[model samples]
Target: MERQLPNFLKNYGSILLLLLGIVVGSIVGGFFPEIVAWLKPLGDIFLNLLFAAVIPLLFFAIASAVANIDGSQKLGRIISTMAGVFLGTVIIAALCTIIVLWFFPVDAPQVAQETADELLQGNPGDTWGDKLVRFVTVDEFYKLLSRENMLAFVIFSFLVGIAAMRSGETGASFRKFLISGNEVMKQLLILIMKIAPIGLGAYFAYQVGTIGPELFGFYAKPLGLYYILGAFYFIVFFSLYAYAAGGKHGVNRFWRNNILPSATAISTCSSIATMPVNLSVAPKMGIPAAVANVVIPLGTTLHKDGSSMSSIVKIYVAFVLIGWDFFDPMTLLTALGITILVSIVAGGIPNGGYIGEMLMISVYGLPTEAIPAVMIIGTLVDPMATLLNATGDNVAAMLVAKFAGARGTLSAADGLNTDDADGTD
Candidate 1:
């Protein structure tokens, strides 16, 4: 216990301090009221600093991780299984958001809408094809470099990584540069995080004091909904998934071993950081080391159920601000597609989904004001997000084990459209 105590504090100390700062600031803002003017600027400065750094950080992180794919992803069958499970789970999470938002719609923040208005004014009548094209790629290379072109940037980074991988020995220097740039961005993120407490505190103060209760309500509704939905999904969906993986025993083993990892994810607010715990617990649940080794590590960056749910909420918040119909069939479908993309890429970019938020902005043409309102949602809901993100990987490993033919693996998909005479199975 003594040995573990230092590690525990080392992991949680910063988070605790940041929470304290937010709490203290909120109380002052709510009661004192007069100090929010100065406090708001501190928050603005922090957010501005964040927005400036994330572009390069996202680029390097995605490109570098993809470049290293040759080493990290060796298990071919397990990779396919993980992909299937990851996408299925995230889609379920997003559909849950759709249902919840229908009953409990979130309103736009009561901040000034003039800027958003100007940006949305004269909404162009571009064809669906043009809109579709712009959603994934920009016409010019320089346009892809900006925050407003996030999806374009993501696609470009992916291509660059794949090109490097395909070039073999000739691309070694470029690969190294990508990795080194990724490391530098990580350090830059660390430097930005060091000021998180003060910035969050200041922002919370201003929000409580002057931004109107509606703005708080703007965040509160989604935050509350997320916890309720997260808990529900964690218990119900995961148990069902475990049962599918290995019947009653799998369910029992998963619950018993999952508590610590769930706790770690919520405390650390990081899927990557919680991965060691998942790796440690996988064997006790009867998951193959091969499955755990592949699923848990790759899942850290590629699988994201929590982010899927939150992405919908974030997009809905923007839709409300823009006066769009959230329940429109086409809009809901578009939201779902974007949610999946965000969940997948969000892990790679880090910084609590700000890059994901940027993706939302670019794809939908959301205005700049949406950034402040939506970026904090990621941080606020991160504990649950990380909880879903991390533990889902563990459960996924179990499923991957089953899919790889560990005792009575689920094979319905293979049976659906195949014939024994074909001999493919």
Candidate 2:
């Protein structure tokens, strides 16, 4: 009986099952939207399970990684590598969007009166220092438990980790606790993922049933351009990055393991929600725990190639609406700079895209009337924006792994959990 089992099942059973679930859900939702609308909660239940487990998991994983660091020098190298890769990718994404907009050119659509009037007032006058303080810290420690404050938690975890490492025998004992907690979290996640195929399918069904038709709405033309551009960037550029990180093997591993995170991002439409999936997928992709834990969490808040790309398109669309020149040299340069900043600030909090749009408006001195157009643009682009934002974190981790040469129970070469020598995944 055992001999009848196939090796392909052993290697790829979960992935195939997952793909099947997505397809089935998408098809049913497409053809019979009313029937599948209620299944959304099933998906939410699955996301909630992972979210509950991940709060502590993120703490232990990140704190333990820092606690176990051999020296500050190596930690600096890891951090430096992470920052360099983030900056490089954000720049590339921004430049790509700028170049594409220059050629294709988004003309403003005649937005509906309701949309232009629907926008709420935003306080765009907040200074950079003010934004930084709020983003990096919360008034109370308990606030860190919220997923929206993930960046603050990242900072806290690093401090606690360093303190544990510095505290002699007591600290060493604490470090063990952190490591054990991290392992427990990983196991908990593996068990949670047993239901992923079903959960993700249900979620995809909800997404397609509820939201798919909106893509063909009044804003379809500009939305279409951004969607096509986002897709092209997601596939072509990410593949190039993977190849650069580890050649064909890197590309193969990245593609195989990334589907879950990509799906989760599209379904949940939040980078923070997808972090756990990325954490689980990272190990299976051979990302060192240190690199995976840090980069993914930080990337959840700090790295946003999709958001950056979308910001440029929003700028172009808003400028067009306001009767401003889209390509004035100094003004274009400012928009490019805003793309990087908006990517960071817009994603740092929940529902922050609204604030990002306001920032763009304030910076460009656009009339409040332009708000509705960009707001709609943001709404339409969010799912794909999130996919790129979340999955690109894993890609950045791979590049950091290549640059930093992280060593532990796993090696990039070991591709330990990545799979057999047959492939990196």
Candidate 3:
């Protein structure tokens, strides 16, 4: 029985279990709609568990990685490389989304009056200065806990980490403690994931049961096309990036190892939730923990390849719905700039698509009524967007590691091995 149990788990792990749940939930919701509300808590509990761990995990993981850096110069090089890779990928994704929309355009559907009113109520009338301030600093430390201000946390963590690195002997012991704490949090994440099937199954069941029918309605075609394009981009473009970073063998190993993490991202529809899995699996793909620790956490907040694609699609749809002339060169350029900026500020929080939608209204000078239409599109493509976002982060980590000279092993250049008295590699 014991041996059989292990084999059973191996065959029916979280991915299979979550898929099964989605199927079963869809069936149940389709036939018995009354039960979906009751089943929602199962998924909510699971999501809450993952969310609870995200901030601390990010803090310790990033702080430890930075503290281990040999000096500010190496850190500067890695940061620059990471930023370049992130920008290049986002631009490519944005261009792909634009081209796809150009070929297969969507006519915006009329949104219900109630939905428009509800969406408009949350508009903050934010200015560029307000947005910039929010990204760089927060009014209170506790506000950093909110996912909306995650970049602020990244900045704070970097400062703390840099200070620790310069503290000499005292910093070594603190870094070790952080490493230990990060390991503990990772274990906690694994424990939470153990019941993912049960949690996700219930959640998906409620989702499909409630929204399954709607998915086949008017929103189906454009959303469906977005999913197909997203898949293509993820598989082809992401693989190419990986190959560039790690070579054919490295790319092969990455795809081979990341199947489960990809599935996790799809199911949860969150890059933040999938960070634990990404961090855990990165070392196996030849990314040193030091690099993975920094890249994955920062990427979760800053990288938005998937969101860039979705935002482009949403903006295109909005233009069509409102009869705005998007073909004007200056208008097109402005839209592209706004899309990239939105992606940068979108963060790793769940339901962050709305923030992008708000930007669309403010930046494009669209009617507040357009909010509901943009948000509806966002909801439909969120899973695919998140899958792309999470997968891109891992790929970016590989490229960053490669650029930093990580070659299938840990070394000082890779930032995994620090020059400390303990000789900790």
List TM-score per model, in order: 0.85, 0.58, 0.57
Prediction 1 TM-score vs. true? 0.85
- The models' CA-based lDDT, in order, is 0.77, 0.73, 0.69
For candidate 2, write residues 1-425 as lDDT tens digits: 67435744643465567667767887878888997768877777876675576567667866886687665335688889888998889989988887887887654434422244434334589887886676679899998886556556657887898888788776887888998987787677668767866777787676567555442343556678788989999999999988887788778878888888887787667798889889987866667788887888878877899888888888887776545667888777777777766666555444456556655665555664455457556766888889999999999998888888786412346445444423123
Stretches of candidate 2 above 4 Å error?
A: 1-74, 108-218, 408-425
Error of 3 at 43 (Å): 27
Off by over 4 Å in 3: 1-74, 108-218, 407-425
lDDT score of residue 297 within candidate 2: 84
Ranking by TM-score: 1, 2, 3
Decide which is better by lDDT, 2 or 3: 2
- Write down the RMSD of all candidates, one decimal each: 6.7, 11.1, 10.0
What is the model-wide C-alpha lDDT for candidate 1?
0.77
The 10-residue segment with the lowest total lDDT in model 2: 416-425
- Return the top candidate by TM-score: 1
Ordered list by lDDT, greatest first: 1, 2, 3
> What stretches of model 1 exceed 4 Å from their correct place?
1-9, 17-41, 107-119, 200-210, 321-323, 348-350, 406-425
